[model samples]
Target: MRHDASRRRFLTIALVTAATAPIALRAASAEAAAPAALPKLPATDAAAKALAYTENAAAVKHAAFKAGSSCTNCNFFKGAKGQAYGPCTLFPKNTVAAKGWCSAWAKKL
Candidate 1:
């Protein structure tokens, strides 16, 4: 009876570990493979300069810039609503501040 109980307990442990091992391994691999966050676009970048991009919309002086405009409200901005910084269509590889502005700013609607 004692030997039978030991064998059953060992078998149960081995089965449980085998069932959960793949799931644990997959979760670890996915975490490791996750991409890092994108870099922020600098206001001084050549492309940014051409568009008159500014980190703060209030400081924009371009003729095309309108009062109360910013990346959060622009058509080219792809950031989620309320995000402080996010990716922009114009600067594909970099994120922009939600309050940033540029000549290309257009109504999201």
Candidate 2:
């Protein structure tokens, strides 16, 4: 009709920009391959020496340290309560220190 409706609206905008250009270049290469922070947990790693991890919960002396246990109140701290460092479902991809301590400290219920 009008040159076949302008060639079917330019082939439906070139088939929706070739079906969304590989999901917008894979979401901009996953936000430029993430990792801008996460990287602290290093008290000699190996799972921070099998959970004796201490970034200074009053310099833990073990015995499953308790007097006000840390990692910003444990339960595998994910950070935010006055964060001095964060993430720690037991150091996945690092970051811990909010006055850390480990022996898998729980009690964040």
Candidate 3:
């Protein structure tokens, strides 16, 4: 009877360890794969500005930030080819156009 109890306890511990082993490994892998630094945005030269979305009147200005373009048309928009963010001369520091807006929008020039 004592042997049976010992075996049951061992099995319980082993089962718990087995279940948690995968979880621990997964967490380690995820942390390892995590980016070392903040992800970068695309370049903003003349070529990047070609995809700007501010020309569309329907596009709204970025909230909170009074100077940058909105995500819809900003040069850094991350949507589809047309829907993605484009480059803007306004926000030189921020790669994603998800920030501010301005009237200086050019037609890719």
Candidate 4:
């Protein structure tokens, strides 16, 4: 009787844990499988040409960051360190820089 009781108790716990394990795995996988977002910049290579700059770095192919700036200090930027590109009221998509820049620019005070 004692052996049977122990076995039953262990089985109950195992079943419960097994059922919950999938839920936990799904949550973890959702986070792990998520792709890291790209950093946004003030302007793309083409967009930079429209801006007024005596030295449009992107225009001359001398841009400091054609596509590598972070979101901490971009014109359309709206975030802090480690955060993905925050939504830009200026642009259609949520984008910012991670060490990037262009001609069409403005420093958010």
- Residue range 6-108, candidate 2, lDDT tens digits: 9999999999999999999999999999877888888788989998898889978889788998989888898898989999886789898989788989988
Model 3 lDDT, residue 103, Cα: 45
Instruction: Give Cα distance to truth, residue 1, candidate 1, Å.
Output: 32
Model 1 TM-score, 2 decimals: 0.67
**Sort by lDDT, best first: what order?**
1, 2, 4, 3
What are the models' TM-scores? 0.67, 0.35, 0.47, 0.42
Better of 1 and 2 by lDDT: 1
The residue-level lDDT of candidate 2 at 4 comes to 98
Worst 10 residues of 1 by lDDT: 58-67
The whole-model lDDT of each prediction reads 0.92, 0.88, 0.49, 0.53
What's the true lDDT of residue 77 in model 3? 40
Q: After superposition, how far is residue 99 of candidate 2 from its true place, in Å?
A: 16
TM-score of 4: 0.42
Q: Give the Cα error of residue 105 in candidate 2, in Å.
A: 4.9
Full-model lDDT, candidate 4:
0.53
Per-residue lDDT of model 1, residues 1-109, tens digit only: 9999999999999999999999999999999998789999986789998988888998877889888999999999999998999999999889999999999999998
Residue pairs with colliding backbones in model 2 are 45-48
Provide the lDDT at 62 for model 2.
86
